[model samples]
Target: MPPDALELLSEKGSAERALTAALASFQEQVQAVPSLDLAAVVEAAKPAFSSGIAFSAQLVDVRGRHKLRVIVMHAGGAEVTSEEWADEVDDLLQAAGWMLAMLLGIPLAKQARPVEAEIAEAECLAVVGVPDASAGPEPSKKEDAAPVVDLDVALEPLTPQEIEATHQRILALPQASRQALTKAFREHFQVPRNARSIGDRITQHQHAAFIDHFLEECEEQSLDGAAAPAEP
Candidate 1:
């Protein structure tokens, strides 16, 4: 075999090994979060590589809520340096693990603080080139913030049948549970108790979270044997 051909084969082998190790590390880190669905991670976490960069994607589920996260890592630098690329890959994987934990509503493990610091350092490096190692962190610029608006104004109204079904489901719950859910719904939408139809209060976009929270509360009550008395 030609020397050039052997060199190319060796580079390819090294890239594969690096990618495999990075993926294993990612899996271990993610699985440490108790709330993350391991089955979903196994099914959705696939790694792809192109042009000396690695990409990974996964759909993580927490308490029946699903979130998809994609991570990209560039292993190669301006020069052909394997060490630089490997370090970059490790940094990205650690950041991705922290991101997934946050998305799933899991608190970050204490050891993961460095990942956040590293991400902040990277962002600073991008904006200011080499940062002064001795200087304290610079104050971030404050920009005018946009006023938040109600989401219901933008959401499409649910159909009559959907509204009716939702009303029926709410009514089927015990009186105390129903009242609690109704109070939550009113507070969430800032709707007057008697001002809007059930359907109007719960738009299509808000329906899933509304119902899921309600069901979770109901389950908790049931497990505790504290279900409210059903209304006649």
Candidate 2:
């Protein structure tokens, strides 16, 4: 968070304290990488973003629950918005964080997956053009040849037809757990905008890779990221 943002939040009344704490806790979560030095990474990370898509998020207390609204602003003057609620403010913030990473075209780190998330990720690869994302034998041309992508080649922006097809696949998930996860995946990965035009080199490669990494992390997450409710 920017110092100005923090300063402004500190001035808000008692009701805003929960949001302040939530933001603090969420910061700890994202910066938990042990190998990275604590102060150095944060000092370098937050600053003015001059170009590309920007993410604007707002979290407010709703009775005892927390309501999160995330808006993805494209450089082209287009935007996408989504709303979700959680009893815990941190949970909603974390999910928003993941969606932000995806939208900003951040690269995902490889992680082990739980059995369920692995299956969900594989099913998603079916739509995103991952080569034979299925665990089965490599698809053949005469058969149901799956689309192949060479990571070396530059990636093209998703066509409306492709976006529609991928979205339909996201809606086909059998369980709400998987559906919620996939929805976040599709919403960001399929957003038709110049991601590379943003911070860092957010090329289409990052976009495609984000799906695989994000899903693996979802499976790897304890309590399954913010997509799942807290276990009682």
Maximum-TM-score candidate: 2
Per-residue CA lDDT of candidate 1, range 40-134, in tens? 33223333232344444554565665444544454832111111122223243443433332222122222333343333332332222123455
Model 1 ranges off by over 4 Å: 1-156, 193-199, 224-232
The TM-score of predicted model 2 comes to 0.30
lDDT for residue 67 in candidate 1, whole number 0-100: 42
Lowest lDDT 10-mer window, candidate 1? 77-86
lDDT of 2 by residue, 1-232 (tens): 9999887665543333433333334333332221112132232224312233345878767787666666655344455454456443334444454434433222232345566565544444444333344646645521343224575543765432333223223223333333344445446556433221122123354453454454444344433433565479
